[model samples]
Target: MPDPARLFQSLSDPVRLRLLRLLVREELHVQELVAITGLSQPRVSKHLGLLRKQGWVDQRKEGTRSWYRARSGDDAPGGTALLPTVLTLAEELPQTDGDDERLVLALGARQAQAKAFFSAMADRWETIRLRYAQPEFDLGLMGGLAQPEARVLDVGTGGGALLPEFAATGARVLAVDLSLPMLVRARKRCRGQAAGEVDFCCGAAEALPLGDGACDVVQCAMVLHHVARPARVVAELARVLRPDGRLAVTSFCAHHQEWMRSELAHQWLGFERTEMERFFRLAHVTPGRWLQRGPRSPDGSGNGNGPNAADWPEVFLMTGIKDADHGG
Candidate 1:
């Protein structure tokens, strides 16, 4: 923690207070922060630097872009004691009429970029998956499916890639996604023998359209990094899961692949295993087994032998089980 004098000095600025409020609501890049706060980029960055130094904010750097967010309560030095005072003071201050509206616009732009990318690439995902990851990632995550007679949900089931696998388990299947074009492709792809047994819904992961304790298993493959708020998604997944329900997530481990954001409309480059574990713990779920593969050989002979093996990062499947006493 910084000295008390310095701490209060940092908090004295309205710009910093506004920035703290904005970042607490969302993790935003420098550009987005500038847009939302209606502040010059340098002014925003200057205050963020001070907030970060005081452990009041966290910054994630990727290539040339940096994402900033208020440090989570658990990570803040005096958050449990000081946050209430800080927030109370903030609430008593002048309200910025346009900040919330601007924030929504910023986030909507991010979502739209992803939707557009998926809409155009819905059909090519099958071929695209082969380019970045091996079968091990998908196959390992599939192990989390529930037995027949149990219900299973595939959250953000892009192109319904795993619909057939879910159906073959003989469990009732539901596929949910944000992209309609992707859902259409998934429906068409799963129309074989057990296709009639599967269901589909177009929805967002952050706010799933499902009842409490809805299913025995939830599989979210390659989906977390695409969403703006993955922790919220995790909580939503837990909200709809039954007691002891399993949650399986397949995603790329943290890496410096900047191309993914532009080429794949990825909101995040990837995620750290520890980061994912924290997400599960916060949602009151027990972290389970983890399976991983990748960083293929230069000769294209490793786990995911694709051309330019050095370009791909590690991929992993992380699973968790809802505690019997976990809240719905």
Candidate 2:
């Protein structure tokens, strides 16, 4: 059991309490904390250090920045007992309109930075990505999960990186994306190799063009967060996959990157493991292997674990199979 007196003492500072309130909603880096709270770095670090020592917060180092989130449940001492009360108290406190305004500015700055990077590198996207360490997952595994001549649907198949992989498996591929320019690039990339094996379609993930039970394997890579309704897209993916077919999705894990929305056109920041599991259950897809990887460098040159690792998004790869008895 934690000392109740010490816990109360920790929450006595208004600054610490405010920090806890922000952290409870989203994981934030020290710079974000400073920006949100209008506090000096020294003061913010001091308060965070105390919260961490008391086991009221957890920290993770990403590159040069340290990210902090409120700890709850089994991860926190005394579980949720004191923390929930503190959070509630923090919420009940007077609101600071300036904090909200500053937050908007901070997020806007991040969005501008991302937008500029993407705009400048759009033509050399693939070459620029090679500068960072690529995600270390065997895409070849998709071939084994697919049957020969299987109808494979690749939703949001940006430049068709995986189209050729599926094509090489002898699966007839349908690569779909909302962007006609991206679809054009994808078609060109897979030109001679995927010649007759692949078909490019301009379509949205939430409303795939194909009929129900049309595909044996449905693969979506890093696209769900961009959709307006991720759950609907999941349902659509499940609907299009035939019984006993597989659905493989790769996406970012939950994070505090709101800039993604304005800059990269992401709808949701990311997803939680529980949310993904719920989607699988709702879709009647039996969840299978799950894997998570930390941020990779944007240049694809260094291991993501290094200090120089680019603040790339943390990603996960999840798969599920449609139940044999499931009716689309």
Candidate 3:
């Protein structure tokens, strides 16, 4: 066989390799990647362009801007497995920084957009909040905390949709949002509840204000899509979980078809079982079980009723535990 030297050359630099790693987790705009990698916009774009020519990356255009994701092959369903050794190699390498840090690049752009997105829609938040964040989903994953008194942290609390469900579960809830206006709406939803019980805060998902291992369980609803650095967010969620804490995070997995792409713009990445497993690995979170639900709107667009039957089978739900052993 020919030498594999040329194959290795494409991913030689820690920076280029790191960019590919981020692409695997989610598709990302080159401009947005600047924050994650701490590199200039041109530099990130250059690396992405090179990766594309190597057939190791692919680009999807949305409006005027373009986003890049790892291309396994032909956009086929279950393509995540096509480059396993590359992914495995990526997993073992130490995380790079400055011009090669994925977290730095991913979070900066996303938090700003998320904050702005929520702030503008604050008025209509309550309607969206009441819709999709269901307790039956959380209770099903973590039944131990069904009591009248439990504590939960709804990370990426968005407009506080999951907060009330958590509160209804007898868990005194803390809803944190990067957008102050969004928090205001969440506060409005919990106004009738006693003070100090259901509370809200203005914060980004990467750096939650709560103390370490502060709550019994932490939840993130469809909001994972809004996050730039999901692995770090998961790490933070794991950080705040009690040793035996449970985590229920819902994320969008790519549909088995290429046609679903146009609708979920800004939905940079979709997870496969391995992809999800890798995310938990980076977060030090562990997967418990995988579940599937209807094409319900993650943004809470439609009535809380499940997604139209036509959109069924493409959506999925994943529940994981913060393994006490995995905690640092």
Candidate 4:
């Protein structure tokens, strides 16, 4: 029941059509569109305004940038009926070589900005990370398995973010980190908390200082990417865990954000679910379940856009249990 006349009128403009075509591929800010289309900011904005008026595009603002995406299916008003046809036509058109070149340049610029920001704030990384909205996962589920006076080891306890969560279960918590400064910050964060006493230790993930079968529950949050030998770390975790002990790991999934390697000191981009499972198998642990969590807006907004929206990483939780037959 859409107005065909309005839909046709909206697509009549070449600039608007081109903008829609580009937006259909991925959400883009005005600056990216300007670069991709080789159009002046004013001209791009003019075309975008017309498209917005026709309900052919949707916009989400994050800080100073406004990201726009083409509306399709039920989202497009007058064009809903012809959305498929329009997308097909757009795909059939040949893309300009210059547009592709400009897109590459724009992507590189995004990587540079992220790298500089991370490099400048490496010491206060945790504080900055907390500013963004993170996907919510129930760590409390692990608490139910805790027994009386259970020994829990938190590997790579950066700023003790998950220490309090584990401590609240009345488990004796041991926090480990490679950086002395990070351990200091973690200690301060856990001070005076109602959770049971927490012990801090300086250690490498690949070579933990604790003895064999030292812990009942091991939690590693967002740390696997930083270790040079992930398999070795997994082996160490398995070695220190008692038979039937639990292991919980949270980390980014494989992504193409190459800047993370140099700027954030990440050794790996991330691990796929199968790769994580294989690591567990090699460590003589039984893999449990894998849960994927996608990125969200920084302010808990549901607009699917934020300051880090362009390169936000997807995270996952992989759990496993040490096999009783293969005791450490």
Q: Top TM-score: which candidate number?
A: 1
Q: Indicate whether candidate 1 or candidate 4 has the larger TM-score.
A: 1
lDDT of 1 by residue, 7-30 (tens): 888889998888888887888899
Superposing all C-alpha atoms, what RMSD in Å does each candidate have to the true structure? 2.9, 7.9, 7.9, 13.8
Scored against the true structure, residue 325 in model 4 reaches a CA lDDT of 88
Q: What is the lDDT of residue 79 in candidate 1?
A: 60
Over 35-57, each residue of candidate 3 has an lDDT whose tens digit, in order, gives: 77668888888888877767777
Worst 10 residues of 2 by lDDT: 128-137
> lDDT tens digits, residues 256-320, model 2?
65445544555456788887987888899998878887766544553433323354567888899
lDDT of 4 at 327: 74
lDDT of all predictions, in order shown?
A: 0.81, 0.74, 0.65, 0.74
Extract clashing residue pairs from model 3. 26-269, 27-268, 35-104, 35-105, 36-104, 36-105, 36-106
TM-score of each: 0.92, 0.59, 0.65, 0.59
Q: Where is model 4 poorest over a 10-residue stretch in terms of lDDT?
A: 298-307
| Model 3 residue 140 distance off true place after TM-score fit, in angstroms | 3.2
